[model samples]
Target chain A: MRAVDTGGYLKGRIRREDIISAAAVVYGEVGYHGASLREIAKRVGMSHAGLLYYFPTKEALLAAVLERRDAEDAEREQLDSPPGLEVLRHYLALASHNVRHPGIVDLYARLAAEAVAPDHPAHEYFKRHYDEARVGVRDSFRVLAESGELRAGVDPEQATITFIALMDGLQVQWLTTPDAVDLVGSLRFYLQALLTVPL
Target chain B: MRAVDTGGYLKGRIRREDIISAAAVVYGEVGYHGASLREIAKRVGMSHAGLLYYFPTKEALLAAVLERRDAEDAEREQLDSPPGLEVLRHYLALASHNVRHPGIVDLYARLAAEAVAPDHPAHEYFKRHYDEARVGVRDSFRVLAESGELRAGVDPEQATITFIALMDGLQVQWLTTPDAVDLVGSLRFYLQALLTVPL
Candidate 1:
C-alpha cells in the first residue's frame, strides 16, 4: 500500500489506490478528451456506473487521478535527499527513473499543459501545486545554498521554477523521442555545471 | 496572416491562413482535445467540413499550425546569433515574443506532448524537430567554443540539450504565468554564471 514502492509496485493494489493507478494509466494512454470513464471502468473490470459510484463524476475521477500522481511525487519528495555531489547523483537517478516509465512524467506534465484552459478541472490543483512547490523548493534551496552546495546568489524560487521547467521540458523531448534525451547523462552534466563555482 | 499575430490587423485577409490562425487560437485556449474544428471554422466564418477542405483533417491542420509557429522560430534562427551575452539576450527576446502569444506556445507544446502516442500524426514532426534542433544547437555551441566564447570542458551537445531543456521548461512557466517570467533578466544571470570561463 506504500505509494513509494520502488520497483513500480503501484500496479497491483486492490484499494482505491489501485483504481486511481489504473485511471492514471488509461487516462495517460488516451488524453483527457480521448479518455473515457467507461473505458477506465472496463480496464478496472467494473461497470461505468460502478466506477462513477466511487468517484461520482468524471471531473472527480480526473481530479483523483491527478491527486494520486501528485501523491506519488510527494512521496518521492520525502525520500532521504542526498547532499553535495550526491544531490546531483540523485537527480541522475531521478532522470533514469522517469525515462524508464515515462507515463508518470507524461501524465504529470500533460495535466499541467491542459491546466491552462479556463474550465480545466485540474486548474486549482496545478496552481496550488506550483505555489506550494515554490515555497518548498525555496526552503530546500536555502539549506543547500547555506551549506555551500549551491552556487551563490541562486534565487531559490527562481531556481526551483527553472528546475521544474527543465524536468518538464526534458521529459517532453524524451517521451516524444528518447534518442534526443540523454536522460541521466545530460542532466548530470548540467548539474555539474550548476554546482561548479569557486569553492 | 502570421500564425501568432496578437495585435489587430488584416483580420479578414487570406482566408486560408486565417483559418489556421483560428485553429491555433482554439487549440491554445482550450487545449487540443478540448478544441473543436467547428469552433475554429466558426471563428473563420466557415463550416466544419469546409474548413477540412483546406487542411484535410485535424491532424494535418495541427501539423500546419505547428509548422507556422516554427516558421517564426526559424526566422529568429536566421539572425546572426551573437555569442556570450548576446545569445542569452536574443533568447530572452524569443521568450518575450512567445509570452505575447501564450497560445502559440501552448499549441506548439501540446503537439509535442501528443506526439508520444505512436499513432499521433505529429510524431515525425516532433522527432525531426528534436534531432535537427539538437544538431543546430550543437553547431551553435561549437561556434562559441571555437571563437573562445565557451567555457573550457563544456560539451556542446550537453550544453545544447540543457539550453533547449531550460528553454522548454521556462517556457511552460512563462506561458502559463507570463508575469512570473523574467526571461531576459534571469537568463542573463544564468548565462553569466555559465560563461564564466570562455574558450
Candidate 2:
C-alpha cells in the first residue's frame, strides 16, 4: 500500500492560490491582454516554466483567477443558498465587501469591458456569468413579488435588470472617484424605493 | 482679394472625420491599449505619417475621439440646455439613440473600464467627464426636488448617483447580451419610480 502525500498536496494547493492572487493583481493593473505570464510569475518569485506547470496557458490562468473570485464571493456571501429578500441583503453586503477589495473590483471591471468583443477569450465567460447572475437575482425578486413585498408596478424581471445595472454602473463611478460615491448606501436607497417592506 | 482654398479646407475636414470614425470602430473592437495607430490609419486608407499629421499622438487621437463623442451627444440630445425633467428625458432619449449605435457604446464601456486605472491615459478625461455628468444630472434632479416633482424621501444627490450608475451598469449588460436587455425601457422604468410624474 502507498501512503498519500497529504502535506505535499496542501503545499501545491497553497502555491496555486498564490499564483492566482498574483495573476489577479497583474490582470487588474494591465488587463488580460496586456498581462504577461513572466510578469505574473516574477511577482510570485516563480520561474515562467514553474508557473506553466500550474497553469499551462494565459487563458487557463485567467479562468483560475475568475473561478477563484466567484468561489470566494459565493462562500463569503452564501448568496446562492439565500432566498427572496435575504438574497438582496447579501448582495448589498457584497457591495460593502467589495469596497474593501478594490483590486478584485478593478480586475472585474477591466475584464468585463474587454470581454465585450465576441472574439475575446472571456466573452463567453462573461455572457454566462451575467446570465447566471440575472437568473439568481430574478428568482429572488420573483419570490419577493409573490409575497407582495415588491412595490406596485415593479416587475421582478425589470427590477432585477435595473438592480444589476445599478451595481455595475456604480462600480465605474466609484472606481473613478471613490469619495464621490456611496456604493452601499445608494444600493440601499434603490432597494428601499423598490420594496414595500423594510430591509 | 486673394482667392481662398475652400475646396481644400472642406476636403481636409472630411478626411479628418473619416479618420475619427475609423478610430472609433477600431477602439470599440480593441480597447485603447490593444488598439494600434497603424490599424486605425489602415482602416482609413491613410499612411501612418499622414494620420500623425492630423493628430500628433495616440493620446491626442484618443482625446479627439472622446471629445467628438461628447460633442455629437450634446448637439443631438441638447442635454445641457434642458432643465429639470426635460434633462432626464433627453438622457433617456440618448440611451435610445445609443441602442442604435452599439459600436460607440462599446467603445465608451471599454474605455471607461480601462480608464479606471489612475495612470491610464484617459484617466483624467473620464474623471472630469463623470464629474460633469453627475453635476448636470444632479442639478436637474435638484430642480425637480425643489418643485416637489420628485417622489417623497428621494434625495436628488443620491438619485443622481443611482441614475448614473444604472445607465452605466445597464450598458455593460446590454453590450454583453443585447437581446436580453431593454436599455431604454429600463431607464424609463427607473425614472418612473423616482418621479411623481411620468417620463
Candidate 3:
C-alpha cells in the first residue's frame, strides 16, 4: 500500500511539472492577461478539466508559473552563497541572458505592469517580490559595506533600493528598444559609480 | 464664409477633445486591449460612428489620448525651458503628483508594457518618447555640466538614460506599493549622487 501511494504521488508531481512548462510557454508567448487555461491545456495535450485538476484556477496556474521561474533563476545563478559583489555581477549576467529570451522578458514585463493594479491576481505576489528583492539586495550591499569595499558615504539601504529600481527600469526600456538600450552596459555603469572596487 | 469655416473647425476640435477625455477615462478603468471605441463613445454620449468620425480608428483615438496626456504633463509642469537640475526636481514633484492619480499611472504602466511589442499601436509613440525624453534631459544635464554643476566624470548622456530609467522603474514599484516605495525620495537620492552641489 505504501509503495502504491508513493508511485501515485510521483506521477502527480510529474504531471504538475508538465503542466507548468506548457503554461510558461503559453504565458510567455502571450501575456498572463492575454492567455487562457484552455490554450495552455491544449498545448500540453490535456483537457481544460485536466489542467484545472492540477492548478485549480488561472491564478493558481500563474502563481505556479511565477514560482517556477524564480526557482529556475535561483538555481541557474547558483545563488546559494555568492559574495556581496558577486550577487550584483550575477544580475548583470542575468540581464545579458534575458536579452536572448525575449518571450520570458515580455511575459515578465507585461505581468509586472498588470500586477500593479490593486485587485490584480498577481498584485500581492509583486508587492512581496519587490519587498523581498530589496531586502535581499540590501543585505548584499551591507555585506560589502562591512568588508569596507563599498564607496564612501553611500548608504547600503539606499543603494540597494536604487540598484533594484535601476534594474527594473532598464528592463522596461530595453524591452521596447532592444537595439537602443544596453541593459548590461547601463547596469555596469551604475555599479561602477556605486562601488569603491571595480566589478 | 471663412469665419463660418473657422467656427466649424473649432467645434470639431472641441468634440475631438471630449472624445479623447472619455477614452482616457475608459482606458484608465480597463486597459487598452480591454477597451472598445463603442464603450468610449457610450461614455461620451455619442455613437461609435461619431467617435470614429473624429479619430478614425481605435488606434487613432489611443494616440490622441496619449498626446493629450503629454500635453497636460508639459503644461502642468510649465516644462518649457526649465534649468538643468530643476528638471530632475520637477520629476520628483511629478512622482508625488502621480500618487494622487492612480488611474493615469496604471494606464501608462499597462500601455507602456504592452507597447513593447513591435506591432503594438503605441509602439512608435513610446520609441519616439524615449528618444525625445533622453535628448531633452540630456540637454539639461549638459547645461549643468557646462556650468560646472555636474559631478566630475559624469557623462550627460549616460546620466540622462539612468535618470529616466530610475523614474520609470520607481513608477512601477510605486504603483504596486504606494506606501512602501518612496518614489520622490529615491529620485532625490539619485540626483544628489549625480550633482556636485547638494540638491
Q: Which scores better on lDDT, 1 or 3?
A: 3
The candidates' DockQ values read: 0.47, 0.78, 0.71
lDDT of 2: 0.88
| Cα RMSD for predicted model 1 | 7.3
Query: Which residue pairs of candidate 3 clash?
Result: none
Tens-digit lDDT track for model 2 on B17-48?
99888888787786666788899999999999
User: What Cα-based lDDT does every candidate model obtain?
Assistant: 0.68, 0.88, 0.81
Q: Provide the global lDDT of candidate 3 against the true structure.
A: 0.81
Give a tens-digit lDDT track for model 3, residues B66-165: 8788778867875546658777677777777887877777777777787888888788888887887787788888998998988777778778888889
lDDT value, residue B9 of candidate 1: 39
Per-candidate TM-scores read 0.79, 0.85, 0.90
* lDDT (Cα, 0-100) at B90 in candidate 3: 73
**What would the per-residue lDDT of candidate 1 be over residues B57-172, giving only the tens digit for each residue?**
78877987887777767677442354344554566677667767776777676667767666778788778777767776677677777866776777877888877777776766
Best by DockQ: 2
Q: What order do candidates take by TM-score, descending?
A: 3, 2, 1
What's the true lDDT of residue A126 in model 1?
67
Off by over 4 Å in 1: A1-15, A25-34, A42-47, A53-59, A73-89, A197-199, B1-18, B22-35, B39-50, B76-88, B176-181, B197-199
What candidate 2 gets wrong by more than 4 Å, as runs, is A1-18, A25-35, A42-60, B1-22, B25-35, B39-59
